[model samples]
Target: MHPMLNIAIRAVRRAGNLIVKNYEIVSTVKINQPNIKNITNSVKIELEKLIIDVIRKSYPEHNIITEMHGKIIGSNKDIKWTIDPLDCISNFLKCLPNFSISITLTMKNRTEIAVIYAPILNEIFSAVRGQGAQLNGYRLRCSNAVDLKGTILAIGYLLSLQQDNQKYITKINQIFKHNYIDFRRTGSVGLDMAYVAAGRVDGYFYIGLKPWNFSAGELLVRESGGLITDFNGNHTNSNNIIAANPHVLKSILLKIRNI
Candidate 1:
């Protein structure tokens, strides 16, 4: 493993452990508990701090961008760490085990390493540039399903982008009408992309995802032999993500273009 990736794995493991501990506690507590929000917030803060500390200790010169605290620049301008300490916060708060911690190391604006860890599932998905993706140490390959009919497709709805709801809805309607493909909204873009890399879902599409939300998953899908691009089939840094195997990607891109 690359030295930075090794450090990332260590940070993710530590954060995952903390998340799982809090998850278990929240699971046992009532949903309406007054301290639920506080607990989740506290966990997010602690995990982010822990990860930041770990990364800074090893690579003090690398920049850091986190979901919770925005961006912190380091002495090194070429390397940046994009992190989401807690993805799928709503699901986490609701005791749904679909959340994950996502971290990506980018060099010169390109993702070089990626890790997505789901503590509840004990699954760690990782990838390095030019190397294949992995899930729990096993190599991953994207699905070969060329047709969308009867295949499961994952879509993410960004609640923050309320104005774009109609556009997304129209696209969804167009997809359903054009094919018999099944669709799911898991509320977690990180997991959705990981699932695409693992072949759990044939494809995943989303609009308005932040850097921390899709950076790690982007590398995973690409390294797993899948294509991730914007609606126009161009490389993307934010929002408008479509990930799938080559064949499926082509088909989906056609559908998206028509919308």
Candidate 2:
């Protein structure tokens, strides 16, 4: 195992342990508990701190980017860690068991290692740049889907206050015009892409995902024999991501190109 990958695994597992502990409390507490929102938010902040702590201890010179605190610059500009300590906050607060923790290490503008852990499921998805993706100790391969028909898909969104929700609704309608089997909006882009890499879902697409949101997932999909591209089939800008096996990716691009 790469030394950086080992550190990332340790950081994510530690974060996952924190998530598991707080999850139990949130699950048993009443939904209407006073300041529940504040409690959850505090947990998210602490979780990011824990992850950053682990990374800083190992490599104090490496830069860090996190969801809660944005970016922390270290002496080394070429190497950075991107972290989403808690993905799918809504699901976690709802006790839905669909949230996850994501950590990615990049060097010289390229992803080198990625780790995502779903504490409730006790599943860890990881990948090294040249190595294949893995779930636990086993290797992963994306579904060899050649067409959209009968394939499950995952979609996510990070809508701004002024963004039109109906526009995305129309886009979803356009996608369903094809004969795809089903769709899931898991509220977690990281897990959605990991699922694509794991073949748990055939494909995943999302709009407005920031670097920290999909950095880990992007490498996982690529290392697992999948492709991550924009709506127009370009891999340059990934803010709008579509992930699938090669053939299915092209098919999806065709399906939603005009929408």
Candidates in order have lDDT scores of 0.88, 0.87
**Residue 112 error, candidate 2, Å:** 0.9
- Candidate 2: Cα lDDT at 127: 98
lDDT for each residue of candidate 1 in 91-130, tens digit (9 for 90 to 100): 9988899999989999998889999999899999999999
TM-scores of the models, in the order given: 0.93, 0.93
Best by lDDT, which number? 1
Stretches of candidate 2 exceeding 4 Å from the true structure: 31-34, 159-164, 178-180
Q: What is the lDDT of residue 108 in candidate 2?
A: 99
